[model samples]
Target: MNKGLFVMALEVSNLNKRNVYLMYLIIFLQGFVFYGPVAVIYRQRRGLAVSSIFIIESISWILMIILEIPWGYFADRFGYKKTLVISNILFFISKIVFYKAHSFNMFLLERILMAFSLSGISGCDIALLYSSINEKESEKVFGRYSALSNAGLFLASIISSILVKYSLDSTALLTSVFYGIASILTFFLTEVEVKNKNRINIKLCIDFVKSSKNIILLIFAVSLINEVVQAVAVFLYQIKLINCGFNIVYFGLLTAFLQLVRISSAKTHVLSSKFGQNKSLMIFFIIITLSCLAFLTLKNIPIIIIALALMCSSSAMISPIILDIENKSISIQDRATVLSIYAMCGDILSSAVNVVIGKVSDISIEASFTFCIIICFFALILLCLNFKGQFFNKYS
Candidate 1:
């Protein structure tokens, strides 16, 4: 549904409508990073080796892994609005730190701040959004919510095509200003009513995951696909672009095209509704699998664009449906915490896959893609293994 039509049909409070639109604006602003289109090259030009950048990222990932559950617990126990308000401020601070950073230690500080900021907001944002809307609208709302970030990136990439020509530092500075504005907006968000639950903590989240067989299976299967997507689309695409003789100056335009592909996220609800969640997920997973196969065997421009479209479109389509399915398993009282647990498990899988893919990529890009193909196949196998009648159908 269109945004205006959705609003007209909402049957929700004015405050709820405000929360939805406000969050859309906030998420879109968060994606307005001028440096994003050229993150690795920008870092390299700022006096750090690619290896050092990876090390910083590894540390940042580890830190977020450590913090995700605790932050979720905080959101569940206190309030989502409070968590968002705090985390968005931290997010802006991290962007400012990035703007000024040139040395490795300085960059590490930025990463550390980002770890705090990102982990704190991990599942809280979605939980808040899910709370504010009617359940039937979840898919449409989440789809558009997912797309707004890419819409921002689409705009940023256009700006970056201009900005990277001048100063990379300017990209970070401009990005910080948008983030600072977003941070302030969080202060005005209405908090969803959180149920008072006892002993909300990391241990509780751990226990919940351990016992929820369906959720455990779902998270593992989906996370594997997400990791491969991040590796192939985000990390490897840049390298492939360079290997194919694309110059650095055109990186923004190229990445912008990918973001344009991701904008298909807004239509995810249609796919999931037509195919059913499990079948929809399987179809998209196969799409990614074929795209990886292309990476392993083909390198022409048309093939490159086709493979990218396949991967990005599949990824965009999958996220909101996955979020919607996962939320179905969560109780209202533990929504934030359980969602964080889902994120943590996904991160654990991602961190491991990233380390292996990084090492493999150092040997051969083809070899790295081969590894991604295996992950995709494994994910497909997991998807097949799911007993929809037992797991998904119950929720449906």
Candidate 2:
């Protein structure tokens, strides 16, 4: 890296750092708010059938898909900080609505707004971060960003669990408070001038699509497969524990432990740098496969706990590696848009899989895990082929 570039990378304006941190805080609040009432909502709401839940989630994802490209263009033209502030405001309002929501219809409305708000925030935050850091130092900065974000997630989950354990009704209110705080913090963030201030043309989008075809496909496929597998495993594991008379708190703790391990492992970049991106991803996929198999075979709580840890660690490993690969392939100008498209692919697949997993769980829990393993097997094969291609030539 050039000396000047190195200095520039480290010299992010105070405003940008503040903005990124605020986005991180909002993401933390988002997870906290969403997960806090999930199990309780399903358990207590008489009208909230599986189909209703799926519909709400599907609507959210559909909204995300519709908004992703336009919002990415908006951020590019208007500025990332402006987009962040707007998103935070929307999210704060959504949280309030969610707290006061009385019926499934109201919940769905709140969720759709929440999804749009979150989608706006997603790509813009990363684009701001990439703009602030030098291209050469982006990987290191992104790694740190991911680690800190995961730590925030772990803390939020712990806090949300405590809130839910004490009073389900209060959880939404508490989450809304956090969202408000995050929204307020956004006011302090500085705006980054987007490189291409002109309106995004179809030509740019098309060129980006053309340039990113292979890597985009890889990211999409891996993300879709991974989410499906993880969702199935989580659904089955939760049901199994509940049926076997395990405590809910224990499950929360198990989830917290998994996140903690993921946070810890994300800080270690040795494997990523040494083995190369594809190899590291391959290892993670293999670990996930083995973990899923272990979960299928093991009946012991302690052993299953270990399997969960492995599962999360493997899952955590995939995102950064894929992001790193994608980053290398696209220009900074279109990076966020490309990544959002990548995420949208996963969201679409996961939404569909959530419905299928819900039905499968009702029939046989083991069948879900078996299905996930099959998906993982397909993922592994695709990944292996990806590793053998020209894509690996540049990275490895």
Candidate lDDT scores, in order, read: 0.85, 0.68
**Model 2: runs farther than 4 Å from truth?**
1-47, 233-236, 391-396
* Tens digit of per-residue lDDT, candidate 1, span 1-396: 599788865645778789999999999999898898888877878898655765677777788889988899899888999999999999999999998988999999999999999999899999999999889999889899989999898899889989988887888899999999999999999887787655565565677677777667777788889888887777777778788877778878877887888989999988887888778888899999999998888878678878988898899989998888888777546889888888888788777777777777768888988999999998887777665535555687
Query: What value does the lDDT take at residue 388 in candidate 1?
Result: 58
- Highest-lDDT candidate: 1
Model 2: how far residue 38 lies from native, Å: 5.8
- By TM-score, the best candidate is 1
What is candidate 2's lDDT per residue for 255-318, written digit by digit as tens? 5665677775555466788987767777888888887787677778777777777777777667
| CA RMSD of each candidate after superposition | 4.5, 3.8
In model 2, where is the ten-residue run with the lowest total lDDT?
Answer: 34-43
